[model samples]
Target: MENKNKIYIDAIKKIAGSSKLLKDEPMSRHTTFKAGGTADIYIEAENEETVKKTVDFCRLNNIDYYITGNGSNLLVSDDGFRGLILSTAALKDTLEVNGEYLTCSAGYTLAVAANKAAENGLGGMEFASGIPGSVGGAVFMNAGAYGSEIENILQSVRLLEADGTIRTADACELELSYRSSNIGALSRVILRADFKLKKGDKALISEKMAELNLKRRTKQPLDYPSAGSTFKRPDGYFAGALIEKAGLKGFSIGGAQVSEKHCGFVINKGNATSSDIFNLIKHIQKTVLINSGVELTPEIRLVGKF
Candidate 1:
């Protein structure tokens, strides 16, 4: 580590303690893809205050930092990141229900939140039951499955702004669209989110959740390590169908292969490297664009230098 980096690391240890700090932690262990090199520093923040303090410290010192939650939709490079990765995964995972609204911390898993909503006879969260991500990440990307999306139920969120201040903002202010949000552009961190749901039959809600999860298990490549849906659904064209029609399903580049079970996902076949996955994604994009008129765009977030 450089002298300046070490100095910041030592300073951050003082703010968040040595237990919260990890040096040269492997990115493969954090990401769902289970591929990539190590990170210089990884901080598992324990609460909102710790997150704020660390962000403030990094800003003041001009240290590069990236916030992560669950690492479900991330693909780190082989060279790894040279900066700090501040994760909300260790924060207090709490869910509270107040009438029609369900409030949860950023660290809370979407599956758990969906189940909790079903338990309380609240509907609308069933569509998110199978998404393998945290509330913060899901909200950040407007994650959706089986037609319903986070924007439909999201009411408000408590955010840590770029200026190191916390405030609640309405869902409309987020400009939640298809797999996009304004949160990252504004340099804001999601502390917590309030979801507005409707009262429904408890049995029906549970049944809907179970049905969606069943469909996911049958259609998605859940057995292998993948970052779920590799490409975004192009306008008027399904990415999976386009790839399949191009005869690229079950194709392999190194250990990275287009999943036979779901052509949309690029899966790591045991010993795949980050480079393999990256190359496979590009190949898929080029092939799909050549075969069909629609160009495919990656849905997963790339980290570090790829």
Candidate 2:
């Protein structure tokens, strides 16, 4: 570590607590892919204040930093990150329900939130019951499944802007569409999300959630480590269908393989490196484009450098 970087880290430690600060933290330990190298500095931020403070500090010091929640849809490179990674993984337990609205901290997992909504007799979250990602991540990417997306239920999001100001923006302002959002381009960090739901029978909601989860378990490659659904659905075509048509299902590149169970996923078959996953994704894209004349785009966020 450089002397100047050490000085900056020390300042962060005083505000975020020594236990929250980690040096050379393994990236594999954080992401769902269970691959990659290390991050130079990692901070497990506990609340919105800590996140704002740390982000402001990083920006003011001209230090590169990335904000993450749950690390569910992320892929870091083998060479690792050269900057700070501020994570919201510690804010997973905070949630509140009022009337037809449920508000959760950014780090709260979607599965837990969906279950909690059912417990509170709220509907409209059943589609998210099996999503293995945090609330902030879902809202950031407008994540969805089973013909529903976050834009349908999302009411608003509390964000920390690049200028160090906090504001609650309505969902309509976000321009949510097909696994993309304006939040990233605007350089905003999601602190929390408010979901507007409907009152429904608890039994019916629970039953729906159970059915969806069962389908996910039966179809998805849960036995391996992966960022779910590697490719976005291209216009007029499904990415998985194209890959299958291209004869790339169950294909292997190093320990990274197109899942035998579902062509949509690229799984880490235990000894896979970040490079293996990257190469496999590219190969699938190239093959699918040539064979089907449709380009595939990755849904997972790539971090650091490949």
Candidate 3:
């Protein structure tokens, strides 16, 4: 709570309501991992305009800020973020549908979007029915499941650049690859996205989503707090298979443990800190490399201090 920080926070509060501004907000309360410390200043901008105003103000003032969506795939440090964290949750309040196409705000969850598409009798997004992340994060990482990724259905994305400009990038321009996208490297704020879909029976689409949801529930370690799959599926080799081969199943470092139910996930057995997970991940990588000669890359993004 420096004088300069208070001044900057006061400026940010004017862009939105006072209730939207939080100081020393607990990071554990925001992320899916249910761990970490706090954010020095957290801004919950209600709409794109507020997000733009807040970001522009920060940029102009030379104040550090990080934009995030959903916080599902992030590991925040125990020391917490020293800068402003602009969350996109408040920006998700709109969903528009036209025939076989759907457009929604970036903060909207993929699961909600998939359900909306199903309600409109739209297909091609059944794989997103169980993803627990926002549209912005999903598109950024080219997230996927069940042999399908967002690139298959994504038409374009409305990205807000750092210089206060908005640009629409097509899927081709994003260079969507296995659990990656070019936009992720650019550090732009995702505003919205258009999804190309197909006309299908609502009942059939619901059935498909239901089947996938069941598969996810049965296989994933839903009982514990985790960032979904901990490692990306390496080319020609599954990360989970390699970890299992390396004998790291149910391996524990502090309270963080490689899930016995599924080796792909690293779960908090309650009270696991950020450092615990980091050590566990490194140990798994080293063991898997020695035993299987394959390196496991983390699917989750690390933020703030370690």
Candidate 4:
């Protein structure tokens, strides 16, 4: 334990600049669910250089590490992570619009990117108006809504490979599918992305975004703490519908409950632990499987201990 702390501290010092490093930072504050344990080493990298240095240090020291965007779709275990957590939330840079294309950093929020597109009179990102995640995370998951998806607009992505080298790839190489991309399964870290949009009237774009935002507000239980949809949509079926039909809506396990407002979401009512949410998810999965013969797969990424 002493040797581990020493190694972590040495790595932190080797990284350049004011990259903040914390030992055992609480995961609850980082995730949308507001439920998780602690991460052994948490580093907030503010720029590409710092991120590269941090990644290099971790690799050289043979440290276990994982990068996270906004943590909107993540569930960390109550027992906590035993390795480094790299947060790219500070890499918030955007280039000036060039024709119908917009270049943005990975750390930029989807809402921010959507608003930027709207501001520049660019259309096609209206579907992401209310997505509570960073640009990198959205692209990694091929995030979609309201009949539009990242695959429709993403042209290219800048990624940092597992060996600490940066590379660029076209959209075709990403292999995007329903809420997933090849990057999600690979070891590459997203640095930036280029999106292609249509030159549309600003008024029309704003109107469409407003309309979608209103729809999201009306349909989703935004008041509660959740990691959005709890389960992935099964082939030819919706996970929420199955859970609802299984009579699990409003079901509670500790402070975690299947949201009555939207059965697809398992929300933290208040003071919910990671264990509570995990148990609720398992229960819902079991019930849905028994009732409908459909195994519900999770959309939310689960990390840390069981």
Candidate 5:
């Protein structure tokens, strides 16, 4: 490790426990794709306060860092990150309900939140029952499926700004659009969110979740390791249909293949590398543009050295 990293590691060890502060930790073990290299340092924050303090320390010390949650839509390069990866995933089980609203920490999984909503006889969160991400990531990307999005039900969020300040932002202030949000531009980290849902029949909510999950299992390549949809849905066009029409389904470059079951998904067939997945996605984009006359964009987030 470099001198700066060595110093920061030593400093952080004093603040956090050895178990939560890992050196050269594999990113694959934390991601849904199950493909990534080691991170120079993988640190977990117990709560929002720890996140703020850690980031503040890094900023003051000139240490590089990246914040991530759940690692669902991420694809880290083989060389790994040379900076600290501060994760809020340690706050996973923090959730509470108050009347019609369900408030949860950023690290809380979307699926778990949805289940909690259902348990409370709430309806809006049923659409997110199968989303493979956490509340923070979902809000950051305005994650949507089955015609519902986080923006639709979001009321407010507690965020940590770049300048070591914490504040609550309302849904409208977030500037949420289709699969996009202002969080990145503002350099903000979501700490928690309050979702406004309506009372509904418990049985109906459960049924909705079950129905969506069934659709996912039947249509998506859940049997394989993939970062959900490889490309964003183009306006008035479905990416999967376009790829399938281009005859690219089941296409392979190394171990990365266009899923035969779901053309939109690029799956790792046991031995795919980051380069293979990246190249396969680019190939699909070029081919789809040539055949369908519409350009495709990736929805997955890539991290670290390429």
Candidate 6:
């Protein structure tokens, strides 16, 4: 523990500015599930400069680190994370719209961006009105809904490479496909994104947003704590349909349960542990694979020591 503290202290000093860093920060507070242990080091980069500096410092020290966007689609384990957790939540910025184009920082939430677009009479992002993730995370996963996706409006993206250099890549280079992107494989950090929208009546856009939001409320289990959809959509079958068919709705393991409202979600029923969620997920997978030949993949990202 002493050695770990010393390493974290050294890394902190190497970074410039008045950046805030926390030691032994509880992961539970940083995740949507509200369950997990502690992180050895937690750093919140308030600006792009701080983000670059911190990344450089970690690289130089051979420190293991990862960036977390809104923590909406993540699950941290019980044993906790020993490395640094970099948060981009403070890097929030949205530029003025020029005609049909808008540039936004990675920290801005998708819902915020959609609202901004609607306010500006832009007509492309109404489908993202209910997405609960940051712009960077949405772009990283190519998040989509209601027959629309980030790839449809995305023009370009600014990214920080592993060696601390920033570069811009065109949308076509991202290779986005149904909740997956090249960013998932590369060790790069998304900084900002450029989106091209269409001109539309503000009232019409607002109506579309309201309709989609209402549909989300009706179909999703929003009353409980969950990391959105629990599993990825299988080839020809929906994960929720399979779970419901298996008679696993309302099934409980510890404090975790399959949401009765939406079988696609595994909710944290007040006091669920990461182990409970993990076990429940495994059981669901096994059952689904046996009952249906299609294997359900996880859309939620899990990290930390098990």
Give lDDT per model, in order. 0.90, 0.89, 0.88, 0.88, 0.88, 0.86
Candidate 2 structure quality by residue, lDDT tens digits, 67-126: 788788998999888888988767654698999999999888998899889999999999
Candidate 6, residues 1-306, lDDT tens digits: the string is: 224667467757557356668888888888888888888888777778888888887787777787888888888988878777888766775555889998889988888888999999999999987999888889988888899999999999998987789999998888888888888577778888999999999999999999999999999989888998989888888899999998899999999999999999999998999999999999999988888766889999888865
Segments in model 6 whose C-alpha atoms lie over 4 Å from true places: 1-3, 13-16
Candidate 1, which ten residues in sequence have the lowest lDDT sum?
A: 1-10
Model 5: which residue pairs collide?
A: none
Residue-level lDDT tens digits of model 5 in 1-306: 244456677887766653388889998888788888888878887776678878888778777778888998889887777777888777654588899999999988899999999999989998888998989999998999999999999999999999999999898989999889888788788999999999999999999899999999999999998899989999999999999999999999998999999999999988888888889999999999999899999999888866
For residues 203-256, write the lDDT of model 1, one tens digit per residue.
999999999999999999999999999988999999999999999999999999
- Per-candidate TM equals 0.97, 0.97, 0.96, 0.96, 0.96, 0.96
Clashing pairs in 1: none
Task: Compare candidates 5 and 6 on lDDT and give the better one.
Answer: 5
Candidate achieving higher TM-score, 2 or 4? 2
lDDT of 5: 0.88
- Using lDDT, give the best candidate's number: 1
Instruction: Tell me the TM-score of model 3.
Output: 0.96
Report the Cα lDDT for candidate 6.
0.86
| Candidate 6 RMSD computed on C-alpha atoms after optimal superposition onto the true structure | 1.6
| CA displacement after TM-score superposition, residue 168 of candidate 6 (Å) | 1.4
Angstrom error of the Cα, residue 40, model 5: value is: 0.7
